[model samples]
Target chain A: MDYFFFIDLIQSTVDGLLFGTTYALIGIGFTLIFGVMRKLNLAYGAAALAGTYIGLVVFLMFDAHPALVFLASALGSGLIGLVVYLCCFRFTPSNYPMASLLASVGMLLFIDEVVIHASHGLPYPYPSVFRDAIIELGDVWVRGDLLFVFFMCVVAMAALFWLLYRTPLGLATRAVSQQPRAAQLCGIDVTRVNMMTFGIAGVLGGIAGAMTAAAVGVLSPVIAMGLTVKGLIVVVIGGLGSIPGAIIGGLLVGAAENIFLLLRGVTERDIYVMLLLFIFLTLRPGGLFGSAQTRD
Target chain B: MLEIADIKTSYGKIAALKGVSLDIHDGGLTCLLGPNGAGKTTLIWTIAGILKAQAGSMKIDSEEILGLKPHQIVSKGIVTVPENRLVFPDMSVRDNLIAGAFSRRKEKGGIEGDLEDVLTRFPRLRERSEQMAGTLSGGEQQMLAVGRALMARPKILLMDEPSTGLAPIIVEEIFEIIGGLRDEGRTIFLVEQNAHMALKYADRFYLLEQGRVTFSGEPGAVDHDEVIQRAYLGARKAS
Candidate 1:
């Protein structure tokens, strides 16, 4: 390849890596919930979109600081997560995974429609925490917002790891994820652990939403469908319950889709990513790091 | 001490335990012997708080615990090593043992010490502490299950069929362990299909038939051969 083309490819790779960080955050959220409850929250993407709207509302109402806007949006999404748990998951039969899956899908549409009704199907300006400045790294230029998102993603994952491994609550959550009955016998309060997991996952999704909106500088109901698809793909490719798997899978998918766009075009990007997911499922159903114990 | 009075539990419409009552004194190995489908496991489940009793009362040291959740019963120092050696298959042996002490929050240092003590008692667990509980052999898994229960530092340990699917030597080893536990003045309530083992290890035994206690007494008072014949082969004859 020509030197100029080689440099462009390297820059594209950098771009993919930057965008992949957000995908990794979303995948972590999905995997965290699925690992414990063994159920998919189809509304996860919509929950993120709803969080963006919450950020917009905060910005418009109080002209709040960017940090406050992010915090308010995250809290709003966490509340929505609790509602989803109480309305969809709490009463559903424990053994019926499909029932919960369907309920989550219903929730996804409900939230999406509500957003559409409120915003009138128009894309609203989402206040950017990071101004759209370009950072020069040698020959390549990187967006400041994308770099900020990458930093936030790292912070979120670190916090999550600390919550999961360093604290008593994390120990109880892991116990419940591995063996709910045994956890209960140990007096871990399984339901509370589950609800907390949901809330935390929702907060992660909310952060992803805020980051995405900040990166693009706009929010729309249309983002829900695409984000939902991307999140699901990332979770499956990462393995359902493996935290590290989600991060690795997210980066792989992000880079792969970008490479596909570079080689072919935007139209075939998702098809190649979906095909990669199919291949992973066929060869190693456990994702990269998921153990056989996750099978049921 | 434990008292189970007139407990009735059902699955849908079919009753598993029907007005079953029994009293176990403190500091003895009491075995419950019955045939398959004789509601022995049902009684164990109810007492462990896995299944709610429709009508009954269960007391641990005179505290009523019939309607409490499983963890609550565990907090009250009544723990069960459930049938099939349900030792949290995915977790490591050490993790499983640590989970046994989950109900107790105080005495972190003491709990760690107790874990060490259990490892010494069941050396096999010490050798395979990092191994997943599911990968251990049947006999080893049984040892881990018992060791996990012991880690709870429970006042009363309820074991259901710990000897099932083990070899003859392993069964004898398990009985020896139970014997040692009794010698230490720990209370154990065992449910077993092996009449011979029950007679050998249990201080008092209850013969259950279809959810009701048909016989209860010291091992020496009952005819050992007759109980075995009836328990294993359903041989009911005139007195």
Candidate 2:
């Protein structure tokens, strides 16, 4: 590659990695709900953005700082996630996985429409928390916002790990994920576990949505459909119920999309990513890090 | 003390427990013996609150528990070590033990003491505390299941088919544990297909057949009943 091309490649790769942190957050939300309920929240991305929007309203309403905005958005999204669980999952017959899946898809459209109507379908600039805090390391330049997002993602994952591996609630969640009926026998309130898992996932989604909007510098309903699809792709690639699988899958997607943008232009970048998703589906459906399915 | 009176449990249209009633005296090792499909498991599940009784009453010392959720029953000091030792397969044995005390998580000090007690009771479990439960041997898994239930600090421990798939030697070891628990004053409701072994440990024995209590009396009565002899103990061939 030429000198400028090499520079472009490096820059794109770094940018992709930074943005991948957001994808990791969204993927975590998707995987968490899947792990506990064995059901996908197709509206997860939309829920995240919905949280961001509500947080925006609160931010503008109270003249809040970016941190407050992010927190408000996250908390709001958590509620949205709970609502989604009640509507799309709680009452639906569980024997048919497709029923819940379809319900979530419908939820995606419903929430998107609600946001569009509420916002009057106009694009709004999300508050930038660290956009001006750029870092320079010789020839490599890093955006401060991206670095902040990256830090947040790492911290969130660590907290999640501690909650799952070191606490009673975590134990209950894992037991429910592994065997709902057996967990019930252990005196675990399976419904409570499931509900809490959804709430947790919603918080993750909320963070992801806020960070994503900050990165793009704009928020609109148009992003929801694409995000939901991308989130699904990341979950499938990361192994549907695996936590670390989500992180790895998200980074892989971010890196690949950036490399493709340089090689095949913006129009063709998505096509190649779609191809990568298909390859994983056909060959390694268990995902990059999923444990082998076992029978007892 | 536990009371089951005129409890009817149905599986869709067919009734599995037809107004069957029984009482388990406190601090006794009471055993339920019957052939397959005779609702032995059904009655245990009903008392455990796994299945909602269609009609009738169940109480633990005047606190009605009939139709209560399973977790509620557990919180009320009734824990069921379900059939086949359904230990959390992928979790470590230590984690499984921790999960058993899930309802008592707030009682950290009590949980720690109960866990220590359980581990002491099963030395084999202590040796393999870090191992995944799925990797444990069948007898160990059964031990883990029982140990897990004990972590609940249950006043009433409900065990279903403890000796179903175990070897003869292992069965005796399980009975010894049952005897130990009774000695400790833990109320036990045991469901067993091993009529011969059950007879030896039972303080009060009930013989159920075709969804009703055919015989509710001493082990001596079960030994004399030709139906119980031929059906459960295989003591005599059906003539």
Candidate 3:
């Protein structure tokens, strides 16, 4: 009822919206891979974390520019993504979908442990141009790093959309996603297309990882677990394989989390978010934009 | 010419195609007529490299191709129009046709020219080129599937039950298209349950039952009713 509370709510929503860009990027990656593979890569967050760590390594060793660090992260994550595809998805027979699913979960833990061991369980400062800067817009203040992340996410998503809708490679990827057999008959190598999908998703994950780390100004293994949870929540809330659904879901979850944090404090915040997920699952399992097809 | 010899394929332990051998002559419309579960679709899939044969040889002009992947087989200029018209449902008709040219992506001019050719061949597709493939009528989807396969510039086209689930009038139209393709000197292997229609355009016919070829010869060598009866009912026991 207080005027200050209304202003706080608006500011929190703005903050959440900007922060949600990281989740949106991660969600887009998940949806892209799921769209092609029809299987969840549970290692996605850990893979992104590994990429961020690589970026931090480059920063420490070469004292690279922030742009170089981001590029390194994307490349490192893309390589790891190919490896994950070979181990977790490629050799496994598709008829046994659970095999790939469990393999990815195993990969998640394996990569997390590797990062923890390498970093000695310590948090590193991630380089960013606007780590401590802020901008004032009317009565609300927006973090400069969050704004930067939002800008980069928008650019990346635009590029991704162009790749999917306009390029020949995009056509093949979409064809494989829609009907793999038909695509194969059209002379598409299904395995090659799938590997490319994972690589692209990995690249997106890397950027999301760097953006999140830069926004927080810290890189730690602990971030990976939370990110994995948040990414899955975003995917489910948005739609399993829908790109637009992922972006909208990410923003919704972000805004919801901030409001819940304001209303119920940090401890109780996630409970309400989980409750929202539950409501979606029960009432609209297809998600915001998912088709009515059953996942299994 | 495509030669398949002693090809065996299985679904887990159950065999779908067992030691099947057949030859598709150059510039001929060869139709495989069979009843439900007669392994007609299985043979089409096997030839397309969608299903791997456990043993045997498939040769395109004496070059063994049995172990090759689907895309590799497609590069050899064999394209398939799968049953149920498996066009990319969410994509526009133009995109679907473009996707068919995926193997030949490096040939920009050929693709553009082929796009024009396919659109001209199927004008209904041109009218709805921007429409989502899933929204097209069943006959249109079949036409799209055929056109999509054609976009690959296939030397040999394999069509599986293109008439399945289409209206009666639509089936005749599709056969007319098949006849047109035959007249153009394109080699075709069609798997169909519509024996009467297939027989009309088929230069050669193979009747398959339970994964083996029960009968095969030029269409003029057999009675139309006899081939239709043999397709539905199993070969009348040696009597």
Q: List the residue pairs that clash in candidate 2.
A: none
Off by over 4 Å in 2: A2-4, A291-296, B224-239
Q: Which stretches of model 3 miss by more than 4 angstroms?
A: A292-296
Better of 2 and 3 by lDDT: 3
Calculate DockQ per candidate and list them: 0.52, 0.68, 0.77
lDDT of 1 by residue, A3-78 (tens): 8777777777777887787788888888888878888889888887787788789988998988888887777888
Compute the DockQ of candidate 1: 0.52
lDDT, candidates in the order shown: 0.84, 0.86, 0.90
Q: Write out the backbone clash pairs for model 1.
A: none
- Name the runs in model 1 displaced over 4 angstroms: A130-137, A281-286, A290-296, B106-109, B235-239
At residue A85, what lDDT does model 3 achieve?
Answer: 96
Question: What TM-score do all the candidates reach, one by one?
Answer: 0.92, 0.94, 0.98
lDDT of 1 at B22: 92
Q: What proportion of the real contacts between chains A and B does each prediction keep?
A: 0.53, 0.73, 0.96
DockQ of 2: 0.68
lDDT of 3: 0.90
